[model samples]
Target: MRFVIKVGTSLIAPGGRIDTVLMRALVDQLDLERHEYLIVSSGAIASGMSKLAFSAKPKSVRLMQACAAVGQSLLMYTYEQLFFGKKVVAQLLLSSDDFTSALRYENLQHALHELLKLGVVPIVNENDSVSVRELVGAFGDNDELSALLATAVKADWLVLLTNVDGFYDSAGRGQKLVRTVRRLTPKMEALCGEKSELGTGGMRSKLRAAMMASENGVQVAIANGTAPQAIRNAIERKIGTYFPATKPAPKKRAKAAD
Candidate 1:
């Protein structure tokens, strides 16, 4: 099955620095030949922060863009090194226009299909260095981006790998994980907590993304990336909060003998 796996900044770079061990393990999991994979990754800014020795995330758009420019290369380089001798990876820096424009979206679909046919893993990230919208909170930390890509590519599953185990209900005694969500409601939205220190998206954003994908006929799973075999487990329905795909509306038959 085709999968669009989104890895958030918290898992990619917990404390500004990129975690090579965790990344390598993820790469190993993706090395399997049975499945086609597309990666939506978030770590450029954090990596840049590490490179520049910044104590905190930059607030200014220009400063953040500068950091993204510096770290984009580092992030891709790390992926290349990790996937070497296993899989060829291509980087695609995208803005919202790429998905919004009719021509651009068609072109993106063709390119992504061709890349997958050639057994290449397309690593996608927001063009943070250039896109003002993306830099100033547009894609909800790439959760929305992943969902869009999943629908565009007609992926069977969109797996979101974050720092948490799954969507939890904090109101019920301790935190209770919601295993399966056939439908998303406003109450669930109210359960969303704060965003991570290094990441812009919180559980709310992830749930929104999941709902987007599910509505588009794509199954979604949100799981903790720090766990062992998280990606595989999510796919196998062994872990995470799973959202089953919503069936498309049936077309009405044309009037006969009119």
Candidate 2:
């Protein structure tokens, strides 16, 4: 199965520092020979903050971009080290235009498919160092990006790995995990809480992304990134809030003759 796994900043760099041990554990779970995996990770800024000794995420756009510039390298380097001798990994820094523009989108699809064909794991993130949209509250902290990538790549599963186990039902006396959500509703939106301090997206943004991917025929699972074998469990529907695809995936049409 092809999976677009999104790991949030909170899990990647809790306390504003990259957790190499935790990251190694996550990497250890990858079964590259059995399935294809693409990672959409968010942590360049946080990793930068750590390297620069910034206590918190900077409000200044330029400063945040600078942080991304510094951290993106560190982030990819770490991934490269972890995946060494296991699988070749490629870094893809993307912007909204990559998806919005027709030519760019087609080119991106071709590139991604080609990389996958070579058995390379693509590590994607927003081009935060240059993209104002991404740095300034766009892409919902890479949630939307993952969904869009999943749709474009025709991924069978889009697993959103976060701190939470799954979406919850907070209306009752205590919060109850909602195992399956076939369709999104107004109530789900109402249940959303605030965004994370370290990360831009919260449950609200995740739900929105989930709705988008599910509608595009990509099954989505919002599961806890910190959980043991989280990726495996999420794909198997053993944990997290599963959103089954609602629409059929559009068949890829052959290019017309010039």
Candidate 3:
């Protein structure tokens, strides 16, 4: 099965630096040789903050861009070192226009197919170094980008990994995880809120992306990236909030005469 795994910055760089422990754990948990796997990762800016000596997320777009430029390589390097002998990993820096442009989109599609065929895993991230809009947070966050990529690649599933365990609802006195959401309701969508200190996306963006993917025939799962067996659990429909695909009715076989 083809799956797009979007890793949030919160999980990758919770405070500022690349959490090697978490990264190692995630890498060790992943065993997707037989499946077509794509990772749309966030955390360049967060990772850059440590390298650039910034204590907090920068306010300037130029500074943010600089951070992304500095952090992107570090992000990939970590992935490279972890997946060294286990699997080959390739980096893909993308812009919103890449998908808007028919040729670029198709070329990317071809390149990804080739990489997968060659037993390589493509690790994708927004081209924050040069993408003006991306730096300024114009286009939707990586959550939305993952949905777009999943659609472009016609992936069977899109699993969004975040700090939150799953979609939560305010129950009686506390918040409770909503395990299965057949359809995202208006109330549920309203629950999405502010972003973390290090990243732009939040629960709302993920829900929107999930709804979009589900509408276009791609199942979606939102789970805690740090949790044990997160990816496996999401794929197995054992944990997280699952959104199954909604497709056109299948043609029915005609009834035979008795």
What digit string (tens of lDDT, one per residue) describes model 1 on residues 6-64?
A: 99999899899999899998878874488889999999999999999998999988988
In model 2, the clashing pairs are: none
lDDT of each: 0.88, 0.90, 0.84
- Number of backbone clashes in candidate 3: 0
User: Among all windows of ten consecutive residues in candidate 3, which has the lowest summed lDDT?
Assistant: 249-258
True-vs-predicted CA distance for residue 101, candidate 2, Å: 0.3
Instruction: Report per-prediction Cα RMSD to one decimal.
Output: 5.6, 2.6, 6.0
- Model 2 lDDT vs. the true structure? 0.90
- Candidate 3: C-alpha lDDT: 0.84
RMSD of 1: 5.6
List of clashing residue pairs for candidate 3: none
TM-score head-to-head 1 vs 2, winner: 2
Candidate order, TM-score descending? 2, 1, 3
